[model samples]
Target: MDDSNENVLTGSASQSLLIKPDISTPLIDSKRIDLQTLINKFHNQLGDKNWLKYQSIFSSFILGKLSRNEFENEITKIINSNLLINFHNQFILSNLANSVRINPSPNSHISGFGFNNNNLFNMNNSNKKKKNLNNYKFNNQYEVLKTNIMSLPVKERRRIKNIKRDSGKSNLLSANSSLYITNPQNNKSSSQPREVITGNAVTWSQDIMTGFQTLLASESYELPDKDTLNYRMTGIMREHGLFGSLDENSINVMSMAIESHLKTIIEETIDLVRYRKSKYDEN
Candidate 1:
């Protein structure tokens, strides 16, 4: 240690005081280095020296043309890699980069070229449209015009009032009953503030379906009992020839009721005629 100090003291003061060249600051003059040329130099230098695992940084910093931060990060990765020797031999040469570092202060590093190159051939992919979160698209397709009925005018739907119904069958048979018969073609009193009959129901044949349709049009048919419902339903089913395909017991019951009512009406009509004739004879 004493011998080293004595030799340094004996050295010329001017030589010792000579300022070192700054490798971190590049020359801004016309002799500026090309990025490709710099990378080529690094590649050639590596040919004569031991391969440093991280020396590919030349491609990233020069040929690959990355920004400064990217260059330092890559260099840091090589330095921290699992290798016996981290840096290339040419990198350690005293004249190569000297004591230059990447960052400005002591807390910084030397992973970079440790210097700036004014002329860099950085590959710019920035101009290309970058695929970010916004670049994504949904895979679904959309329809333009709706072909549904809902697009029609609302007023086109005319409301048909349902026939009103009552449970009393006797009430339906009265003169004032909404179910009372009418000859639309004849001058017949409907037992109300009488009005002239319209010719709507005048048809060639007395069709059962025509009667039912007319009845439904004139007034609501009220059901007196569930049996009455079976009566009307079975009647419709019979007219349509579908009655035998369904439950027979209920159909038979309604048929019996209808037959009994018809018989009673016929017998009462006969008794009324005999009584009226006997009264005429007594007079």
Candidate 2:
């Protein structure tokens, strides 16, 4: 009886060990992507030739053979095509990137009068505006006007009432002409404001190419046409008005810009194709 009992106990223990719980074992199947599915997904984003050319690179990245940062950088380069195009339509259209600067010439002549401590003026002989004013004295009306103006608080001096009544029948032009204004310069001089474009034209071409590349990478896979380009370029110059309102020079510039960008995209696409072919062949 004891032996039989021991045998029964051992058998039950063995049976328990052999039988597993009702719960199923978890699997990694959910994590795995089907090959066909992956191929189709990539094919949609990139065209057939591009998919083939970039397959190995993408595969390596997905399979953990490539580091995450390296993969992201490679993807960025592919998308941007290594084009550093960071510019705004507003900046370009407003010509803000091409800022103007007025630089005084070192050789330009400047003359002025200096007042002494005794309240006497030592006018520079070459100063044309003050040349004949040595014997000049302010008229009574103007003197009174100046005195009253000087008595007012600084801000209140600009009030129209201060000059409206005092500035008798003289028209605005005549009143302005009567003021004895002197200038440091003996002669009137002018300098043209110089506008300098800060960036290279290649930036525009690159920017357009990057956008074109992005479009190709999308599902639509459409290229921009002349009308589309015109519309978009007009939008950039919205502050100025529509494309029709643009002057001949502006229109020509925009046309050239669009043509150059399109040309750049084509050239870049050809080069990319060639590069892919070589890389694929080597692999």
Candidate 3:
């Protein structure tokens, strides 16, 4: 009885082991690429004749005419032909080059005064017009007008008052710009009030420079047309613009600057195309 029971147990265990399927086994019946047919289709068209034999060998291996080890060795020899080895070496050298850089993202930001300080610099909102005349300083004459304004309704009174106040303020400031008027009783310059700058005023040179920067950064920043170039060049001869009131020597220096700028742009563009072409060739 004991011997028979042990035999039954052994038989059942053997059956279970046989029933279990291997999960690690590869799907060898998966669809394979027809390298031979593909190569033959291109054989006549292909300038490189070296690839023709590889297709036959690959097909033979696929058809069970060659062992896996023999196929691997032979195919490796074919794929790593002189041309392929040179291409692979070139790829490796390029990867090494891309990994190394003399300067990392050097042009990611601007780097100059009033332009490169953390971000592109801009003037404060001093030039923006105020919504009201509350901050405007009126002259003594506006006081008499304000008294006459009191007779009007509240909303109308306020509107008329502001208009008159602003108008008087503008006239007074313009008059004060030319004259350093002092108190008649004292007749001393020390007693005179210093002229206050109005927010509407801006330096023309600074404004021009800011505009130039915007123009350069704009979408229209292609090489200037002849008319546009002529217009810009003529500005140098102006008596009031950024390049205005300059001597002949200064104008010549500025012309050199324009030439240098255009030359640099063209050369850098050439270098960019060359670099891209070299990278593509390596690939």
Candidate 4:
């Protein structure tokens, strides 16, 4: 063959060889690693005493401090460690990134440069679970208190108020009830009933009791039992001297006391409600 013809034939063969196949095989096969092994390896390399502190490592890895191979190895180590199972996706991802040196794309699979959509979805779901867990812990107690308080009748609440009044010698007024007596000079035989201050004392007492009951019923807590509610109320009242001398100062104090008391109860109740939700989830 002529030299030019030989060169042309060789070029044609090289071009044919360069053409890619319609179906391409993956460079790295994706596989699920054992979670326990991953965790153990992670602890061995980074020390397990303070796992929370190293949570940022996962983020660092995604940002790219390690090669794809090295990152996969470390991630596999973490997954097999069993520790990652306990953590939510955000925690796992952040810690893993921090521990490794790799320029991981925000969307890169732990397996390598190859993309896996499932892992991303799993990570998002894990984060949601963690957030829900935290919220549940906070609201558990509050719901209990609210339910219990709401179940009490207005009359029964009055009886409880009388009991509290008889038990204590303090001049401080119970938020549950108040007494108001009218002078006879205001109206003689008005038939409005004697000692009435435009409104009946019983009615006023009921109103106050109802307000407190409503507050209790609506409030949330980490622990919703009676003991917790009582303790929390007492603490708040005492802090503001709600059960002290009855005067203008005392009135102002009581108002402030109720405000503070209600605030604490509300906050605690929210925590309790969260707890209840968490417990329900566990069950």
Best by TM-score: 3
Kindly list the per-residue Cα lDDT of model 2 for residues 156-182, writing each as its tens digit. 877745565543532112212210121
Query: For model 3, how does the per-residue alpha-carbon lDDT over 50-163 read when each residue is reduced to its tens digit?
Result: 433443454454344667667655655544434443332333222222222222233332111111111112223343422122233233336756777787799997676577
Superposition TM-score, candidate 3 onto the true structure: 0.21
Note the clash tally of each candidate: 0, 0, 0, 65
Model 1 scores worst on lDDT over the 10 consecutive residues at 136-145
Residue 214 local lDDT, model 4:
26
Q: What is candidate 4's lDDT per residue for 7-110, written digit by digit as tens?
A: 22111121222322211221221232323334444444444323322333333343344454554444444343323333333233332222222233354333
TM-score of each: 0.17, 0.19, 0.21, 0.16
Model 1 stretches astray by more than 4 angstroms: 1-246
Candidate 3 vs candidate 4, lDDT winner: 4
**Evaluated with lDDT, which candidate comes out highest?**
4
lDDT tens string, model 1, 129-233? 222211321111012112232455555322212345444531011212111122332345455422222112111111222222222211333323444344446
Q: Model-by-model lDDT, in order?
A: 0.33, 0.34, 0.35, 0.37
